[model samples]
Target: MGFNPRDAIESVKDIATNAVERSADIVDSAGHILKGDVSGGVEGIVSSSMDIATHSVYKIKEIATGRGDDLDEIV
Candidate 1:
């Protein structure tokens, strides 16, 4: 057995990518169909969703790096 740095790096990348994709999906599915204030503008929802995805990716990066301190700022 031996340490595989590439494997670890790939794992982290996968986690971050998955987190971002999932976050965007969640926001698109739920945040864009409210039929209320801010719902009439798709651009606004998309911008908000990108913000959310960015936050989610940051949180995932924190977790992947084993430094989740102050993660509350994400949610």
Candidate 2:
């Protein structure tokens, strides 16, 4: 077959388009994974902080009412 310039240009264009599409897909997948990991980490940290705060408040209440002596029993 004859090597036509127009055909060669079209082939190059198609290859470039495919490469760009694949790269975009890879970036999109990576972004989703990173977002999920960050969201989960943030949720865990919030839960742990709330637990610590609740425990601290309970301890403060006990100490204020002279029930600190029974701390071990309550726990």
Among the numbered candidates, top TM-score falls to 2
Which regions of candidate 1 deviate over 4 angstroms? 36-75
Residue 12, candidate 1: C-alpha displacement in angstroms: 0.3
List candidate 2 segments past 4 Å from native: 36-75
| lDDT (Cα atoms) of all candidates against the true structure | 0.60, 0.54
TM-score of each: 0.39, 0.41
Candidate 2 residues 1-75, lDDT tens each?
A: 344556555555655555565556555555655778666555555554555555555545454443434556665
* lDDT for residue 17 in candidate 1, whole number 0-100: 73
Clashing pairs in 2: none
Clashes of each: 0, 0
> How does model 1 fare in lDDT?
0.60
